[model samples]
Target: MKKIIFIFLLALSFGCSESDSASNDSTGQGGSLAVFALKDNYLYSVDHMKLNVFSLINGEKPVKVNDIPIGFDIETLFAYGDNLFIGSRNGMFIYSISNPENPTKLSSVQHFTACDPVIANSTHSFVTLNSNTTCGNNTNVLQVYDTKDLKNPKLIHSRNLMQPKGIGFYTAKYLLVCDDVLKIFNIENPSEPILVHAIDKNCFDVIIRDNTLFAIGDKGVYRYKMNPNDIKDIQLESETNF
Candidate 1:
């Protein structure tokens, strides 16, 4: 499940700011799958059984403000504006973070039991459920949901995937990591994702910033130059194995 989190910290860190500087952003959950997300001066994280909230108001010492009992097997954490999206093996939990330190539960959408991670843009939220994990299920699927209403999340589209893993958005483009294959899609039309390219490579999680793609896998890290026009035209600039 640690392999399910990946997103650009530069984008997530500026939760309340309009600045686009990379240095201002930092990832609390540094794994492929993020279990921690920072918003404004508050940080929210989930362990196997609880949602932990921290306050960075003091800046000198991050204080534990709250710990909400959620459920078992919490896999991923993502923050969008005033909403916090939590993905567990059994469902997606939505929360309203209008009061950054105190998050209120909004709703929960249940799904087939599997290892799931989530990412979202302005209009839609994307979730990938993978089989062949400790979760004990063989259902691989990608779910697209309408996020216009934060309190009530409606599923707009569902497609069977091939061991889908970490997912992220590069503007209107969607990056999906499935096994060793990286798939790109243009999601201007949220309900219908148009396939842009499929690159054969070892990828578990990815972060795109400054027109460059950073993919991490068991082997190591790979750097690629992103070509929005033609994903095939994207060049692999460097590779470092750990």
Candidate 2:
């Protein structure tokens, strides 16, 4: 029942996504939509279905280096090793970021209607098929690819799940999936991911703080007991932010 409600809420909010810069117009998630890499300050995320690259530190204006067209329902942005990757409704899109001012679109691969926003790693990208796709109804599968060669990626593995929901990767080995329960899988072997653990309630996006894991749930953002070793030990610590 809780899972159903989340799906409905997320689906209902899709139509609100729009294009046009925030300064030029007034639309989108009210300029709150954002994604950024704590490691790289050169790239920043924008709500209007594109990414902004800083030409210079503290520049007067950020440039829309990548033109993905906001109306396409893009939700996530990740930049790693001179490349940028985005998660859209259709699939995952890869771009070359040799020049911060101009990001080149390398490819757009189709999958399911992905959402709630995540990128596994700059080298390994993952997306949750939140809902069904035209190809077939979603059975909750996480697509894991060998992006070592960005230009021509190889489909390394697919972890089929039930309502993959949102995802977060700690060391490119463990994939924490959000759903009615928190599902953790050890992808030490991407081709054959092994189940690590599962717990009840909501788990959306997850992050790391010191040795703890921060998870985003329907209620709010909270801390979790994340063991680099054991998944069964994971337990909620305290609520932080949503």
Best by TM-score: 1
On the 0 to 100 scale, the lDDT of residue 66 in model 2 is 43
Model 1 vs. true fold: TM? 0.86
lDDT of 2 by residue, 51-140 (tens): 555433455764444444534666666545566667766677777766655667776677655553445444566666665353245446
Per-residue error (Å), model 2, residue 169: 1.6
- Per lDDT, the best of the predicted structures is 1
Which pairs in model 1 have colliding backbones?
A: 4-33, 5-32, 5-33, 5-34
- Candidate lDDT scores, in order, read 0.73, 0.56
**Stretch of 10 with least lDDT, candidate 2:** 24-33
C-alpha lDDT of residue 102 in model 2: 66
**Model 2 misplacement above 4 A:** 1-41, 59-71, 113-118, 132-139, 240-242
Model 1 poorest 10 in a row by lDDT: 14-23
**Which parts of model 1 have CA positions greater than 4 angstroms off?**
1-32
Model 1, 1-242: lDDT tens digits are 22322334333333323123132434333322677877767878899988899999899998999999988889888776677789999989888888877789998889999998887656778888888558768988888989788778899988887888877666566555555488887787878887778778867676666566777776777788876666668888998776
